[model samples]
Target: MNDRLGRLRDTTINLAHGSGGRAMRELIEDVFVMAFDNPALAALEDQAVFPLADLVRHGDRLAFTTDSYVVDPLFFPGGDIGTLAVSGTVNDLAMSGAKPLFLSCGMVIEEGLAVDILRRVAASMQRVAIEAGVSIVTGDTKVVERGCADKLFVNTAGVGVVPAGVSISARRAQAGDVVIVNGFLGDHGTAILVARQQLALQSDIESDCAPLASLVAAMLDTREDIHCMRDATRGGVATVLNEFALSSGVAIRIHEAALPIREEVKGACEILGLDPLYLANEGKLVAVVPAHAAERVLAAMHAHPAGRHAGVIGEVVAQPAGIVVLHTGFGGQRIVDMLVGEQLPRIC
Candidate 1:
């Protein structure tokens, strides 16, 4: 029976897998259990159980997060809505410096949606959960009338535990603190635009829809002086930085050169008249650290596989509290304002 699905990557997935039969068992064993070979997951119980963590001294510090994915086309160049669902929820929990523990997935399917397509999406979601070291302990599935829903929609809720002394939030940025980003910006938005086929450009721009818990965990392990952390998802880096500036009562100036924008993404932005700085990113994050801990934190981030291209892009400075400006390469300064309207909708 297992030979039919032999080695996973080939069989793809069919609706039979979710029908409570041998196909169902094979799907879980071959993809979920196989990829995530851990005692915690191997139990195959209805729910996952684990200690919250000894460091959560104040109380049961559980960081909860949830996100819904209805990305058009469901499937894209680098990932599908399935991958986006898991990564988005997990990344949010991790942004609080918490280690992801368990997840619950809710799937809504249009009546006419292909079962095969649904299987493929489920398989992709399982793979993402395994890699993130979190479990889909519980889930719900519902079928919607045709044309009433957008192909398929996935909602994932995640919980994680934050270690002692690791407190991070949007308002944690402070004056004289350094702002560092995990990697290049706007890769996800540009990639989505290309995949949507609305615009044509010469390049293979892939979405950066990936899990970043490991990178965040590494940073926390090395330093606790980390003031804040946030994944720049829907609103892009510009919004993420602007929120901090207002919350911390400081102004920020980012060097255009220091901000990493892939040449392809930059080209795409120029071609479409889009600003990469204002575009969305799924796999990137911003961290605010005390000036003294900046180098150490950056070093730890750069050492991680996901943060290899980490950069100290800017810093928080005293100002009128709600301004974010950028220094352009052509010897000019520009006000990098937040989006006045929805420039790019359904981004995440």
Candidate 2:
């Protein structure tokens, strides 16, 4: 049996691997279980069991979020589906000022996928989960026939505990709030596009796919009065700002010069006639904080690696509620509204 399972490691996935038979058990035990080794996961139970007392020590509220990753090619410059699965959900929890505790991974893998590929992805997930100080406590795997699914797709659901007295919501933005972003924007979307090789473009840009829990923790430590926070994922900063504006019934105005966009990303956007504001970001976040805490938060963010490029980009206003405005570098002001349609598909 050991020899058979060892041989399976060098081979490819087949329908039997998902049949809930010996093959399925071997795959799970050899690949996922070994990679994500932890007491909660080692029990091999249907659900991860945690003591209620262990959870309540962190906070009074619970933060739960889930996200799916189907980025074409599976592997990109900076990360893969596994990395995305962990970071995406972890970021979601952190956006609520929660301390991410555990994650559940769900994978839909196509038949004939190289076992080595699966191992690599599982390893990536473990590594990122460790970096984010979280555990992969439970998961499920399914192998579909070739062409029935993409090469690989990952879904992750995360659970965290929100600290007491920390209240973050989209509707918390106020007129005197200041907007800030962590690091560069649009690298993830642009990197995926370039990786497709359809545009025949060349650049050294890499996706900013990283877990933001620590960065958020540092910001929260600086001050817990952060009004609103959201990872600029699918619709980028523009979408998040729009959501905040509409939810809080306030207008947001951002400065173009202050926007932290890479030159390579800007060049790609100009050629494709795309707006960097709408491009997706994996590691970036939009934070609406009180004006007084802006500098302090920015300083704290700069002290961390993930937020080294943090900057104050915009501020909330009273008039024109539910609108986002941009101060163009050309000395013109324009309304930056929600993205009309998909700018880049299969990104993040």
Give the worst 10-residue stretch by lDDT in candidate 2.
1-10
- Total clashes for model 2: 0
lDDT, candidate 2, residue 127? 98
lDDT of 2 by residue, 1-348 (tens): 233344244379998888887888788888898899897776667799889899999999989999988889789999988998899999999999999999999889899999988899999999999999999999888999999998888999999999999999999999999999998999998999889985568899999999999999999998649999999999999999999999999999999999999999999999899899999999999999999999899999999999999999999999799999999899999999899978888986
> Number of clashing residue pairs in every model?
0, 0
After superposing candidate 1 on the true structure, give the runs of residues whose Cα lies further than 4 Å from its correct spot: 1-60
TM-score of each: 0.85, 0.97
lDDT of 1 by residue, 146-247 (tens): 677877788999988887777787777777888899898998898888878867775688888899999998898786588878889887999989888878
lDDT of each: 0.79, 0.92
Q: What is the lDDT of residue 116 in candidate 2?
A: 88
- Cα-lDDT of candidate 2: 0.92
Stretches of candidate 2 off by over 4 Å are 1-10
